[model samples]
Target: MIPAAPLASGRTADVYALDGDRVLRRYRSGGDVRAEAEVMRHLYAEGYPVPRVHHADGPDLVLERVTGPTLVEALVGGDVGVRSAARLLVDLHARLHALPTVRATDPAIRILHLDLHPENVVLAPAGPVVIDWANAREGPSALDRAMTALILAEVAVDRSLPLSAAAHELLMAYVAEAGPLESVAAAARLRADLGAPDAARLPDAVRLVLAAGAPGDRAGAGNLALPDP
Candidate 1:
C-alpha cells in the first residue's frame, strides 16, 4: 500500500493510520520487526491487552487501531489522576505477568515488556492496553518490572516528560506489587547498556528507589515522596 502521511513518530518506528480501523507501523531502525510482531501475536492470543496484529512485512506491521488517550496524555489533560496512574502502572504488569508463558526462543522464562509505562498504555474503552513491543524479551519478571521503574525514573529525573508525577507514583506502586527488589542495580545497568533515550538518568533513579527501600516499609509508601530531579 502507498504510504500516506504518518500520524505519529517515535525513536524506533513511524505510525501511519490506515483504513480507520487499522494502522501501519513502519520501523525507522534496523531492529527485528518480525520479532516484535511475533511477540505481540503471542501476547494477543493469550488474552492480554495488546493491539491486534493484522500483518507484518519486514519493517512494516499492520495493527488494529486502538482509540483512547495514553495514560500520560490522560494525566496531562487532567482526564486521570496520579493515584489512578499508579494503579494502572501496577495493574498493567500484574495483568501481563499473570499470563502463562507459552513459548520463547531463549530460556522460556516469563515474557518481559522491558518498556511498560504510561506512555505505552492506552486506556481503551475496554480497559488499558499496552503498545510498543520492540524492546520486549523473554526473561525474569523482576527484571521486566525493574526496567519499567527505570523508565519511570528516567521520565522524572532525565527526560522530564511532563508526566513526572505519574512516573513517581508508579515507582512506589511497583515496589508495593513487586515486593522486595533483588538486583535492581543489575537491571538498571542492563537497560542502560541498551541505550534507551533516558539511559543516562537510570542510575540516579534506581539509586533513589533503592534508597527509599521497599514500599510499605519505613522509607517507602509510609513516607512516600516523588524522587524528582
Candidate 2:
C-alpha cells in the first residue's frame, strides 16, 4: 500500500514508508527497476552495506528500512569530522570495488556506484549503507572513484552551497587517499550527461579535482570543461 506521504525524496525518486521494516522507492518517471534491484541484491549477497531488497517491479522497489542520518546530515550536524568522512568514503569505495561484478566479460570490471556522495549514504546503526543504485553500473573502479571525487569537487567550489569550505577540505583529503584519478575526465563527461542543475559549475569542478590530485597526474585536467552531452 502506498503511504500518504514520502519518507524522503531525491532527484529521481521518492521513498515511502511501506511498513515498519520496509520502504518503497519509486522513480518519478516510471521505468523497470529489475536491473537496479539485481545490482543491489548482488551487492547484498557480497556482504556490502546496501539495503536488503524484498521486491522490485516497474518503478517501485521495496527494501529494508534503514534508519539513521545521511553522511551529509552527520557532517553538517558536527557529528562527524571532514577527515573521518573522507576516510569512511575511501573505505566504502575499497570495499565495493573489491566485490566482483554481477555480469561482465571484463575481469577488471566491477560494480560502480556512479553516485557515491555523502547524501547518498546512510550512516545506519550497523554502519554506513549506500543508497540510490540508479546510476550503478559495471566499470573500472577508477571511474567510480573519479565520479565521487568530481561530485565533491563541484560542491567544494560552489559558494552557493552550505559547507562549501568543509567540502573543499573533504575533497583534498579524499583525493589524497583516493589513489590515481586517471578516469576523472571520463567521469566528468558522464556527469555532464546527467543534466544536473548545477551544470554551470562543472568547469570549476574539473579544475578543483585537478588541483586536488597529485602534481603530475593533474596535467590535461586543470582546464578541462564539461563535454557536451
Candidate 3:
C-alpha cells in the first residue's frame, strides 16, 4: 500500500501518490469504475493525451505518474498562464469531439472529463494531461464545456482566480472551431437553473444527463441560469 497522503477526493473516487512515480486511484466500490476504466482506455487508444493505466484490481487503479504543475496551479501565476491553459482546453476538447460520431456512439462512450475545470488538467511536458475522470460518461460535449465554465466562474468568485477572459475566449474558440452553439447555450442555461434555489441540484442534473443516454438537447431544457459574463 502506498503510504502517500491523499492528493484529492471526490464524490466517487480518491487519488493518492505512489512513491512520487505513480498515482493510485480508488473508486467508490458501488460506483461505475468499469465504465470509467473503459472510457479511459478508449480515450487513450484514440490518442488523447491521458495518464497511462498501470494496474487495475477491482476498485483500485494505478496510472503513470505525470509530472509538472496542474493547470490550476499554473493559472495562479497570471492571465497569460490562464489564457494558455484555456487554449489547451479548447484544443483538447476539439480533438476529442472530432472523433468519428460512429466511434463516439460506443455504449462505453462518455464525455471526456465531465469535470474539466482548471484543476483537473495537468500541464505536462507533452502538453495538458487531463486527470480525474470520475464524472466522465457518455454525454454531450456541451455539458462538459458548461461544467468547466461554471467551475471556472465559481473559482473566480470564491478564490479570486480570474479566468473569465480565458473562459470566454475558450468558449468562443470552441464555437468557432467545432462546437454546437445551441448545445453550449443550453448547458449554460441548465447550470443556471440547477445552481439557483438548490445548488445541490447541479450534481443531480449531471447524473440525469448521464442516465438519459447522452442526449444532445437535455442540457438546454428546464430553466437555465447562466453566470454573469
Candidate 4:
C-alpha cells in the first residue's frame, strides 16, 4: 500500500513509504524507470554505494529505504567538515568513474552520475550511498567531475545563499583534489538546459570553475544529454 503523502519530494519525483522498509519513488511526469533501475543494479553488483532496487515499472520504482541524514545535513550539523566532504565527493567520483557502463559499447566510456552532489548523498549506516540515478549516463568521466564542480560553484558564487561561503571553500577543496576538469562549459549548458532558477548564474559559475584552475571548456568537449530509455 502507498502512503497518503510522500515522505520526501524532489524536482521530479516523490518518495513514499511502503511496507517492509521499501519506498516508492514515483516520477511526477511518468516515465519508464527500467534504465535507472538497471544502472543501480549494475552499480550495486559492482559493490558501489547505491540503494538497492526492489522493483521498477513505468514511473514507479520500489527501492530500499535508506535511512540517514543527507551529506548536506551532516555538513550543516557539524557531523562532517568541508575538507572531508570534498574528499568524499572526490572519492565517490573516482570510484564511480572506475566502473563500466551498462549499455555503452565504447571501451573508454564510463557511467557518469551527472547529479552527484551533497544533496544526493545519503550518510547511511553502511556508508555514503549515492541516490537519484535519474541523470545517469554513459559518458566521459570529466563531465561528471565538471558537473559537480559547476554545481558547487553555482552556489559558491551566489552570496545570497546561506551556504555560499562554505560552498566556496568546498569548491576550492574539491578542485584541488579532483585532479583534472575539462568540461565546465558542457556542464553549464546541461545545467542551464534543466531551466533551473540558477541557470542565469551559469556565467558566474563557469568563471568560478576557471578561477579554481579547471581547464573550463576545451576545443572538442561536447555537452551531454542522453535520452532516457
Candidate 5:
C-alpha cells in the first residue's frame, strides 16, 4: 500500500500517515525494516507501549498511530513539568528493562532500547507510549541506561537554560535509577560499536554526566573508563 503525505521527518526516517489507525515509519536507505519490526513485535508481546506493527515490507513500517504530543513537544510547549518528565521516563525505563529480551547479544540481559529519549516518547491517553525501536537490541541493561544518560548530557551541555535544566534533571534521574554505572565498564566497547546515531558524543557525555551527578545520586562518579565519544 502507499502512504499519504509525510507527517514528520527525522534524520534517518520519515513518518507518513497510513490511515486512521496506523502510520508508516519509512526509513531511509540501508534500513532493515524486518529487523525493526521484529523488535517491536517482541516488545509488544511483553506488554510494552510500543506501537503495534501491522506491516513491515521493504523500508516502510506500518505501526499503530499513537495520537498525542511527544514529550519533547509537550515540554517545549510548557505542557509537562520537569520533575514529572524525569519520573515518568525513569518509570518507563524501569519497565522496559524488566521485560525479557528477544535479541540478546549478551548473557543475563533484557531488551535494550538504545535510543530512548523524550523525543521518542508520546504522551498517549493510556500513558506514555514509546516509539522508535529501530535500535532495540541486547547487551547489558546498564549500557542501555547509560546511552540515554549520555544523550541527555549532550543536551545538558547546551547553553539554553530551559533545555539545560530539563536535560540535566533527566540525566541525573536516569543515572540514579540506573544504579552504579560501574556495571557498564566492560560494555563500553559494546556501546561504542552499537551504531547509535549520536554515540560519538557518548564517551564525553558519559564522563561529564557521571561526574556531574549530584551528591544524592544513587550512582556515584567513582571510576569509569569511557570509550571514545
Candidate 6:
C-alpha cells in the first residue's frame, strides 16, 4: 500500500490523508486506539456525527475525512466564534448524554468525554463533529459538562480572549435543556463525588491563568481554596 500523506499528529496518534476523502490513523502502540475505534464505530452507527470507519488494520484505522476548521481555531479567532463554539459544546453534550443508557452497559460505556476541549471538535457545514474519542468513557454528564466548562474557561483566560455574553447563556442553556432540578442536582453531586484530588487538580491546572494577577511567588503554590462540597 502506498503511504498516506500526513494530515495531523497528536500526542498518541498520527493521522494521514487517504484516497477519496478518507484518512488513515496509526496510533501509538499499546495505547487505547482500539477501544477508541470501537467507540467511534458504535457512536457512528447510532447516528452521531462521527467519522465513518472504512476499515481497521491492526492498530491503524481508515475513516472518512471530515473537512472543516477545528473549533479551537475558530474560538481563538474572536468573541463571536468563542460563543458559537460554547453553544455548540452545550448542544453536543446534551445530545450525547441523551443517548440510550442501555447501550452503555459495558463498564467502559460512560457519557463523559474526559477531554472535551474545543481542540477535539470540528465545525463543519453540517455542524459540530466531535473527534478524538480516546479519553471517552461511561460516567456522569456533570463531569462531562464540568470538564468542558473548565477547559473553555482556561482557554479564554490563557489567551486573553474575552468571554462572550453567551458564556453564561450557554451555561444556562445547558441547565435548562438538562431538565428539572434533578439534573442540576445530579451534576453538582457528580462534581462532588470526584473527591478532592480530581476536583483540586482541575482548577490548579488552570490556576496560572485563573489567578494571573495574584501576588508573587505563587508558582507551584497549593494554597488555592477549592469550593466547599
Give the top-scoring candidate (TM-score). Answer: 2
lDDT of 3 by residue, 1-229 (tens): 7655677776667788886778888876544366666667777887887788877777887888888787757756653453466577777776766654324556334455656766677888888888876656556765666566544443333323365455444434433343333343455455565344335344444333333233454555444454443
- List candidate 2 segments past 4 Å from native: 214-229
RMSD of 1: 5.5
Model 2 C-alpha lDDT per residue in residues 4-38, reported as the tens digit of each score:
89999988899999889999999999999999999
What is the model-wide C-alpha lDDT for candidate 6? 0.58
* Clash pairs (backbone) in predicted model 1: none
| CA lDDT, candidate 5, residue 105 | 48
Whole-model lDDT per candidate: 0.74, 0.87, 0.59, 0.87, 0.74, 0.58
Instruction: Give the TM-score comparing model 3 with the true structure, all chains together.
Output: 0.67
Q: Which stretches of candidate 6 lie over 4 Å from their true place?
A: 2-5, 78-80, 102-110, 153-201, 205-229
Model 3: pairs clashing at backbone N, Cα or C within 3 Å: 109-138, 110-137, 110-138, 111-137, 189-224, 192-225, 193-225
The true-structure Cα RMSD of candidate 5 reads 3.9
Estimated TM-score for each candidate = 0.84, 0.94, 0.67, 0.91, 0.81, 0.65
Error of 2 at 72 (Å): 0.9
Local accuracy of candidate 5 as per-residue lDDT tens digits, 132-195: 8877777666667666766788777655546877787767766666555544333334555655
Task: Return the TM-score for candidate 5, rounded to 2 decimals.
Answer: 0.81
As a TM-score, model 1 comes out at 0.84
The alpha-carbon RMSD values of the candidates against the true structure, listed in the order shown, are 5.5, 1.9, 7.1, 3.9, 3.9, 8.2
What pairs collide in candidate 2? none
Which digits, one per residue and each the tens of the lDDT, describe model 6 over residues 25-123?
888664436667777787887788788888876768888888888775675565345445556777787778777543567543456665665678887
Off by over 4 Å in 3: 7-12, 28-32, 100-110, 157-181, 184-229
